[model samples]
Target chain A: MFRYLVRRFLQMIMVFFATTFIVYALMYWTGGDPIQALAGEKPVNDVLRAQLTKEYGLDQPFLVRYWNYITDLLHGDLGNTLVGRPIKDVLADAWPITIQLAVIAIVVTILFGVTAGVIAGIRRGSIFDNTTLVLTLIVIGIPSVVLAPLAQYLFTIQWKIFPTTAGGDASLWDLLLPGIVLGSLSVATAMRLTRASVSENLRADFVRTARSKGMPGRRVIGIHVLRNSLIPIVTFLGVELGSLMAGAIVTEGVFNIPGVGYQLSKALTTEDTPLIIGIVSVLVVIFLVANLIVDLLYAVLDPRIRYE
Target chain B: MTDIHVSSPPTVGGGRHLLEVKDLFVEFHTRDGVARVINGVSYHLDPGETLAVLGESGSGKSVTAQAIMGILDMPPAKIPSGQILYKGENLLAMPEEKRRQVRGKEISMIFQDALSALNPVFPVGWQISETLRTRAGMSKKDALNRAVELMDLVKIPAARARIRDYPHQFSGGMRQRVMIAMALAMDPKVLIADEPTTALDVTVQAQIMDLLGDLRRDLNMGLILITHDLGVVADVADRIAVMYAGRIVEHADVRNVYKHPAHPYTEGLLDSIPRLDSKGTELATIKGLPPNLMRPPTGCAFHPRCKYAKAVCTTETPLSLDLGHGRTSACHFAKEMLDGTLR
Candidate 1:
């Protein structure tokens, strides 16, 4: 198991470098000059442009700048943004908010989505199962872009249950509405995945064996069926965790919650190369770590799977 | 063959048997149609007797065991009419909660493919001790100790150390031992082993059969051994019920059925067994597939596959006729079969 972990850690390092480099290269090639965008209505002379370019290390070749960024990252220095705010400070503020949102969303997903899935699977083809099927389908059909704003309007403007925008400090209460919107699509996916897995495992011979033991129906479904069904759901949730923390651009925008998505969008408009690369590099690390944990969890859930 | 007359099995209120399935009919309401699985199948088991329900795949042997165990899914698998009487009480008419109480306590079942039957994720010992803990209300430690004792009872070597191991860790034969151990944990009065040795190696098959026979004698538990292997049944089973197309075509003492099969299907089953005396000869095989349950043929379900099929056999269903000496054969030419006159 230790050997497997070492190998996986090495692989994660490689994937992180490759993904961050791709994001860096794509932004560099596509983005307009940061200095020109910063200048806005004012025209900058050649000497001032040169000074600005040198200050931001833009005069260097792509490889040299990339190498410089990597060395800075290794030394725990995430360079300043085009607006001159430290990227580390921006990240430090945004990451906690996003983590809060993601955690709450995951709880919501488990409470409603997983519970509904288990019930639907046990009582397959029942009215509750049919209702869950239709509801999850509708939730999945509407893209988050439309769903987020609609949720915000319903909860905040119409229902007066929540504020229109997140308050300063982004407390658990402030982020609750955005968290549900961010997790709505995932709830649908988790429900469907869990339903399929549970119903399939119900027919498994071991389940028959359990029933033959005269185990009460509740214990049979709760302990035997649910344990096996959790394998796929855990995998989905791990991957979803990484995406949820970084991919809440629409929900964050709809509720004006200060998170990675909001910072990323602001960086894109200003062509803040360092901030974009910094945020993306953090996201890459998160995705790799989540995948590693999922692999480890697989061995725990199924005894047949050994790490080594 | 003995000429003495033996009476039919006692139905409910007549007398007590360990377990009796009488005129049981099971049908599955599938999308295509209602596929009749068990068609008026009846048999009985007494203390220390191993009654083998012999048939090929799709013969409803496993389904019958499932129905008796009270594990069949209700809507898809409906027992239209039947009385599964346990000690003069009809299990078919019993409440589900009451039946559940009797299932693992009074009657328990083990299944084919032990690797699949045993829960993969749990330790083998935990699975064995489940009924002890939940039903008997024993503590975890005591239950686990009992699990080790049960494992040793089934002859699994090093049962103490291996109790913590998972099902996949054990070999095929050892896994089967674990399944037997689990079934015997509650000390049920009647134990049903459904094709227990079908997934095992030939050499291992004999060992499992022997274990089951010995356990039956030791516990004096009624054992229902379901298998298609005639070779596996000969030594262990006291009586045999030959099923074809969801119906029992013949039933008699094991030796009588082997020595002189009254039903054509039973004859075909016996003939198909490979023997050293028949070296270099092409093996005998029963003709035609088992009938599709959704649309079974008229008359005897086995008529299309029977070598002695006659004109009457095509249109008239053969009733299960009582042959003397506790034997019954559902064949149009049952008398000729017993007299050795049917060619």
Candidate 2:
């Protein structure tokens, strides 16, 4: 197990360097001069511009700038933004909000998705199965963008229940609808994945063995079916969990939430390289961390997957 | 559902015949539509008899076992007619909850593939203990202790220490042993083992068969051993039921069936096995696949494959011919077969 962890951590380091280079290349080609954005439309004076240029190393070679960035990154330092704020502080402030939303969305989806899937699989051809299939397909087939506004209109404007936008003092209910809307895809994914897994497992020899033991349908579905089925569902959840955090930026924009994604859009418009890089870095970290957690979960779920 | 071995687990009272399956039928609603599978199957288990259901794949041997156990999938496969009576109680007519209680407590089944039959995620010991804890109401500690004891019953080596190992950790023979141990955890009155040793090596198969024989004698539990291998059934089964196209082609005492195979299908199967005493140029083989159930032949299902098939065999299904010497054959020309006139 320790060997597995160490090997995974080492692989993660390799993934980080490869990812950093790719993100760096994309950002560099986007053609933005960070100095100009920080210094406004015009230089203050020729002397002031030169001094600022030298201080920020803007006039240095591109390779030199990338090298310096990597050097700073190694020392646990993310560079300052065009607005003169430390990249780390700005990123840290927004990171938790995004994390909280993503985690909650995933948790809610996992609980409901897996439960609905197991029920649907066990009682297939029943009304419950029909309803779950219809609902999941509806959520999956239609775009979330369409659902987002329609939900905001129906749930917020007409019913006057949920808040239309994310607010400072927003309660859990306030975030519930948008979280469902943003996570609607992930929810569908989890549900469908869980459904397929459980249904397949129900036909497994062990399931027959369970039934032969005279275990009730419910216990067979719950203990024998769902537990084994969740392995694949958890794996899908892990991959989706990362993409949702990144994708939640659009959701943040749509819902007007002050999360990393919200800041990222604002940062992109203002050409703030430091803040954009910072947000991407945090996202990358979360992606890496979530993957690691899922790998560990696989080991726990099936000891056969244990590295040792 | 013959319960000839039902001595009632030593001290338990005589619970009727222990199990009786009468006129059981299962039809599958597949993509091609409803196809009749088992047809008017009837059998009973007394107490300690090992009744072997012998047939090739798709012969409805496994289906009958599944139905008797009430484990048949309902949508795709439905039990339209039958009475599976355990202790004179109709398992089919009884409430599902009542039948469920009878399941792990009274009857248990060991399936075909041992590797696939045991859950991969759990330790073998835990799986055995699961039934023990759930049905027998034993605590985890007590259940686990008994699990080791049960493993030892199956002659699994170093069972106490190896109980912590997963399914993949064991060999095919060992995994089958674990499955047997799990089935015996609740001390079920009737154990239905479907192709138990079909997946094991020859020596391992012998070992498993011996272990089952020993365990059956010890527990006095009725055993329903399902297999197509005639060789394996010779020593273990007290009685044997030969199935073809979902019907029992022949049913009799094991020794009688082996000594004098009444039905053409049984004779064909027996003739197919190579003899150690006399070496034939080529071992015999029964021709053709078993009839398709969707549109089975009008007469005997085996007639199309029977070498001695007659006009009578094609036009009418022969009523079971009672040999009167504790044997039965479903064949039109059983007299000819008896007289050694028909090949």
Highest TM-score against the true fold, candidate: 1
Q: Using alpha carbons, what is the TM-score of model 1? A: 0.96
**Best-matching candidate per DockQ:** 1
**Whole-model lDDT values for every prediction:** 0.89, 0.83
Lowest lDDT block of 10, candidate 2 chain B: B1-10
Give the chain B TM-score for each candidate. Answer: 0.95, 0.93
Top-scoring candidate (lDDT):
1
lDDT of each residue in A1-308, candidate 1, tens digit only: 99999999899888878887888789789877778877876899999999989888888998898889988987989888877789999999998999999998998898888988988988889999999999999999999889988988898999999888994487789899888888888899999998999999999999999999888788889899999999989988988988887858878877888899988987877777788999898888888888888888889988989988
Q: RMSD of model 1, in Å?
A: 4.1
Alpha carbon lDDT at B97, candidate 2: 77
List model 2 lDDT by residue over B1-343, tens digit each: 2232222242235445767788888999999977899988887787788999999999999999988888887878888887887776678886777777777668888987999998988899999899778877889999999999999888898999998999999999999999999998878989999999999899999999998888898899999999999999999999999999989889899887777778899999998888987675777899999888999998888988888887888889888788885577888877677778886
Individual DockQ of the candidates?
A: 0.84, 0.77
How far off is residue A119 in model 2, in Å?
A: 2.2
